[model samples]
Target: MLAMALSTAPAHAEDGYELWLRYHPLATEQASLYRSRASQLIAGSATPTQTVTRKELLSGLNGLLGREPTSSDTVTSDGAILVGTPSSSPLIASLRLDTKDLGKEGYLIRSVTVDGHTATAIVGNEDVGALYGAFHFLRLVQTERSIDRLDVRESPHIKLRVLNHWDNLNGEVERGYAGASIWDWWKLPDWRDPRYTDYARANASIGINGTVLNNVNAGAEILTPRYLEKVKALAEVFRPYGIRVYISVRFSAPMEIGGLKTADPLDPNVQHWWRSKADEIYKIIPDFGGFLVKANSEGQPGPQDYGRTHADGANMLADALAPHGGVVMWRTFVYSQTNADDRAKQAYTEFKPLDGHFRDNVLLQVKNGPVDFQPREPYGPLFGAMPKTPLMMEFQITKEYLGFATHLVYLGPLYEEVLSSDTMAHGQGSTVAKVIDGSLGHHTLSGIAGVANIGANRNWSGSDFNQANWYVFGRLAWNPTLASRTIAEQWVRMTFTNNEAFVKPVVEMMMGSREAAVDYMTPLGLHHIMGPGHHYGPAPWDASEARADWRPVYYHRADRNGIGFDRTRAGSDAVDQYAPPIAAQFNDVKQTPEQLLLWFHHVPWDYRMRSGHTLWYELVAHYTQGVDDVKHMQETWRGMDGYIDAERYQQVAAYLAIQEKEAQWWRDACIAYFQSVSGLPLPSGFAPPQHDLKYYESLTFKNVPGYSSW
Candidate 1:
C-alpha cells in the first residue's frame, strides 16, 4: 500500500512550492497506524531551536496524520513522542539512553516505556540535534516506515555540509537557471523574507549546517558595513535552524574596502585590515562561517598578485578567523593562460607543492573533477595527492553544462561515483569519501560544498527533478556511502508519489539520467564542448575564442585522422599526477575505462573498442543510445499524469519534451562536427546528421541566461 495515498487534497493543483516537505495526508491504514504511534508530543520548546522543532513536528503531524497530536510536557498518553536533550527535558533525562557517544549534532530515536506508557524518544546532545531528529521522525511518517520498534541513530560524517551560492550582489546568479537571486539584497537587513526560513528548514532537514551566501567571484561591496548588516539579518533567520552563514571574499577587499594601497598577505597593514574586518563581522554574526576565496583563478586577486603562494593568501585570512572558530575554504579551481600544460593538471601542479603549508583551519576546496564540472571526468588527483592538507569536495549542483534546468539530469549518481572512487592513497580502500571525512588523513576538520542551483523559483531549484540534486547533495554530505538509488527512491516517494508503479520507473530514470546526459553531450570523456559563456548546447566547432583553453576546439582536438586529447606520457603526461597504479592503468589505452577513453589517450578512428566495434561506430551507438534513453524517459513520464498534481506533472512533461528536442540537437550537431573533422561516414544503420557541418557551426545564441558577466 502507498504510504501517502492518492491525495485527499482539493483538486487545486500544486506548484511544487512545498518541495519534499509535502506532508499530504497518508492513506487510511497508514494514517491510522501513524496516528496511534504519535498520539501526543512531549518535546520541549525552551530555546528558539526547540520552539521551531516543536512547530515543525506539529505542522508535519497535522498534515500527514490528518490531525495534530496533543502537545504535552509529560508523556501521559500511550503513544507519545518525547523529544529533547538531557538538559532540556527531564522526561528524556530519566530514560538514560546512551547519548554520550553521540556527537553534538548526532541524535538517537528509540522506542521507550515511560511510566508504563510506551513512547518514542528522540534524544540528542544538543537542541539542534533534537531538531534534526524531529525532522527524521516526520520523514518516517512521510515515507510510511514502521515506528513500532524505532531505534534510528544518525550523525553527519562531514563536519561542514554547506551550499555555495553563486548569487551576486546585483541579484543575478551566475549559472543560476531558476530565476533571480533569492537574497533580495535591497529588502534585506530591514525585511527578512519568510522564504529564507523555509530555505533553512529544507537545508536543516537534510543535515546541511552551513551556507556560503555570495558568489566566489565576489564583490568588495559585500564586505562593507551596509551589507554586513544585511548578512546579520539573514543570519538571525538561519540560526534557529542551525545554519551558519559564510561569504565568499574578494581577495583585494583590503584595497577595495579598507583604503589600503596593497592587499598583500604578508603586509602588516593588510593583515591588520583583515583582522579588523573579521572582528567586525563576528560582532554582527557571531556564528558566521569563514571566507570562501576563489583567488588567483579566473582573474580573481590573491597572494599571487604580490608574488606569494596560495598558502600565504589562505593562511592570512585563516589567522583572522581562528579566534572566532572560523575556517577558510580556498578554491583549487586555479588555471592560467600562461601555462601551456593540460588544464586538468594545473590544480594538482599548483597546490601539490604547497601541501601542509596551509594553516590547520584552511581547507583546499577541490572540484570533483580536476577540470571544471564536465558532464563526466576522472576524480581529481588532489584527493589523495593532498593528504597533508584538509580537502573538501566542491560539486556543482547547477547543471550549467548539462542542458541547464530543462534537462532531467540527476546528479546523485555523479556525486556517488566521485565519492566512492578509490584514491588509493594508502594502498587500497582509500576512497574520496574517506579523504574528505578526515578518516584518510586523520585530520579533524572536514567539509563538502555544492555550488547551489537554488534561485527565486517557486520550486527552489529550476525544475521539480532539480530539487533532487540539492536533496541528494545534502544526504550524501551527511553520509557519503549512501546509494544514489536509495536517495532517489526516498525523493521520488516524498516529492511526487509513493505509488510503487510510479516510483520504481522514476527512480530508474533518475539513476540513468546523468549517464544519458554524458552519452548525448560529452561521450567518451570529451568535456567542455558546450557553447562558450552560457554553456547551453553543443559547440564542437567553436574555436573563435581568444584564449586557447577557453575554446571548444581546445578540448576535443578533433583532427582528420582521429579524435580525443592525448594526456599520455607522449602528450600532456597528466595521468602521472595520479597514484602510480592509476597512472599505469590510464597510461595503457586498453586498460583505461572506455567511458574515459578520450580523456587519457588519442586513439585512431578505426581502433577497435571493447565491444569489438570501431571507435567511430561505438561513438555513434552511444549517441544514438542517449537519444533513445531520453525517449524512454518521455515514455516513462507520460504514464505518470495522474500520479502527481497536474500542474507539476504537466510542467515536467513539457520540460522532458524540451529535453528530447535538445538531446536530438546535441546528437545532430556533435555528429556533424566530428564527422567533418574525422572525414568518416556515419556508422552503418545510423541516421545521418539532420544538417550539414556549416549549419551546426553557424548556430548562435544571444541573451542566454546564466552568463557569467563578472
Candidate 2:
C-alpha cells in the first residue's frame, strides 16, 4: 500500500520523507519470488532487543515484499527466514558456522535444510550480530541480488564505522547543507520520534555500526544528567540496529560542568571526575561507544594548555573508559598560532614524536588530508609516520568545501583516492587503507569515520544526489577496497532504477561528478580558494581573516608572475616528509601528475603543460571544460526524463539547472580573477567572462541556507 501510494503521486511532488528506504515494489517476477520466500519471519523469543530486530524485519519485508511477515516462536517447515544468535536458536547452533572466526560483529547467511525443510538461516554469535545479519539479508533483496543458494559471511574490516555528526546543542548543523540537526534534544528521553528508528534502520542497512552524536565543537552541558537522559533515549533506539552512540566531549567539561578549578589531565581530581562521569554515562547507556575529543585544535582545550602532551590528554580519557570497554578518539587536526611552519605539516610535527606513548584505548583520528578536506589533496603524511599509534582516517562526506548539497558531487572517488594512496610505511603496498584497517601497522583496533551529511531534510541529505555520498561512505567504510565505480553502480541501481538504460548513464555521470567539481572549483591541483567562513563559492580575492590559514590567499599564493604554493626543497620542503620516491615525483613539475601539478609547484604563466599548452592557457581550458561538462550532464539528465519517476526526474533536473548556473559562476569568477593577476589573454576560441574581476569580487551573500553553526 505504501509503495502504491508513492507510485500514484506526481513524481516531482514530494515530501522527501522516505529517503533511500522507499522500498518501492520490485519487478513482477522478482516481487513474486520475494513474497513467497519471505512470507514469514521466524525469529526467536522477543527480548526488548529482539523486539526491535523483529519490528525492523517485519516492516522492511512488508515494504519490499508487499506483505507483512508472520512471525513464530519456532522455525516452520516452509517459507521461513530464521534469525537469532547461536545461544538463542538451535537452528543457528546446528550450522557449526565456525562462529569463533566471526569475532563479535560478524554474521553468516546460508541456505540450509532445517528440520528437513528448505530454509535460510541468518545466524550470528551475538544478538547484535543477528541484527546486522537481518539487515544484510534485507539489502540483498533490495539490491535484487539472488537469494537462492546463499552462502554469505561478512565481518567489518574496520572495527569502528562511524558518522561524526557536526551537530551542536542549538540544533543548527555546522557546514550542514541539508537542514537542522536530527537530534531534538529538547524533546528527547520523554518524546521519541519514530524517525529515529528509521535513521537507525538506514545506517544498519549499510553496516555503519556507530554514530558520534554531537559536534566536535562540543558543549559542557551535554554531560549534565538531564542531557544524559536524552542521549540514553537515542542510544536505546539505535541499539537494536547494532549502532552505538558516541559523544563529542568538551575537554574542559570537568571544570565547566563538574565545578572543578582546572581541567588538567594529570590532576588527581580531574581524573576522578572523568572516571565518575564515565561511570554515570555507562549506567544510563551501557553500550555507550565512548568519547570523541577535538583537543588542542581550533581553540579546544587539551593537555597542551597545561604544558602536557596530546598523549597525556587522550590517555586520561582512555583510563576512565578502559574498564567499560570504551575507546577515546583523539583528533590529530591541530595547529598553533605560534608555529611559523606550514600548516600542512603541523599535525605530524606534534603527534609523530609521541607515537607509542598513548594508551591502548586511544586512537588518533587524523583527517585524510594534512590540510582540511580540500577538493584534491595528497594523503596525509602522518598515516605512515606514526608506527605505534593507531590512526583512524577521518573523511568529510558533507562536502563543506566541495559545493555543499546543491552540487551533484559523488565523493566515492575522493575517498578511494586517499584510501588507495601508498604510504610507503613498509616499502611498497603500504596504503592508507592498510594502515587504518590495522593490517600495515598490526594495530589491534582500527576505524574510518565520515562526517555525516544527514539532517532533518526529508530526503536525509538535502538533495537526492547527495544521498549517494552517504551511501558510498558506508560501503567504503565496510570494505575500504571496493572500486568507486562499482559502488556508484550499486547505489544507482538501489536508489534509482535497475533499468540498464537508466542505470548505465546515471552511474557514468556519478563516477565523473567529483572530478568535474574539482575542475570547476579548484583546477590543476589548486586548493582552498573558496570563500572564507562559508565555503560556498569562489573567493580567490579574499585575504582578510583573523587566522592566516582561514584565508583563501594563504593557500593558492597566486600573483601576477606565477601561481601555486611551492612545497619543494626551495620552498616549505613539505615534500621531504614523504617517502623518497614519492618525494622525487612531487619535487619536479614535469614528473608530477597534471592533476596535482599546481599543488607542489608554482610555475611561470608561460611554462608549458602536459597538454602542450602554456600553463595559463591550460588553466583557462580546464575551467571552461568544467562548465561544459555540467552542460553535458544537464543534457544527459534531460534525456532521462521519461525513464524515472517524474518527482525524482524533475528534482534532479531542477538541481542540475542550479548546478549549471553555479558552474558558470565558478568558471567566470575564477577565470576573471586569475586573468587579472596573471595578466594573460584568454586562450583562443574560449568565451570571455561576462563581468570583470572587480564585479565578481564585489558580490557577497549575507544570508545562505545551511550556514548556521552546529
Q: What total of clashing residue pairs does each candidate reach? A: 0, 5
lDDT of 2 by residue, 420-499 (tens): 99988789999999999998888989998999999998788988889889988888898999899988887777777778
Total backbone clashes of candidate 2, pairs 3 or more residues apart or in separate chains: 5
TM per model? 0.98, 0.96
Report the number of the highest-lDDT candidate. Answer: 1
Extract clashing residue pairs from model 2. 11-646, 11-647, 12-646, 12-647, 168-710
* Candidate 2 root-mean-square deviation in Å: 2.4
Judged by whole-model lDDT over C-alpha atoms, candidate 1 comes out at 0.92
Instruction: Put down candidate 1 lDDT per residue, 1-710, tens digits, no spaces.
Output: 11122223443678776789888888888999888899999887778999889888888898888888998887787999998999888888988899987898999999999989999999899999999999899888898888998889998899999999999999999999999999999998898878888889899999999999999999999999999999999999999999999999999999897999999999999999999999999999999999999999989998998999999999999999999999999999999988888999999999999999999999999999988999999999999898899999999999998889999999999999999999888999999999999999999999999999999998888899999999999999999999999999999999987899999999999999999999999999899999987899999899888788999898888898788999999999999999999999999999999999999988899999989999999998888889999999999999887888888999999999999999999999999889888888888999998888788888898978788688
Give the runs in model 2 whose Cα sits over 4 Å from its true position. 1-14, 69-79
Relative to the true structure, candidate 2 reaches a TM of 0.96
Q: Over 4 Å off in model 1, which ranges?
A: 1-11
After TM-score superposition, the amount by which residue 140's alpha carbon in candidate 1 deviates from its true location, in angstroms, is: 1.1
Give the CA lDDT, 0 to 100, for residue 592 in model 2: 88
Q: What is the lDDT of residue 190 in candidate 1?
A: 93
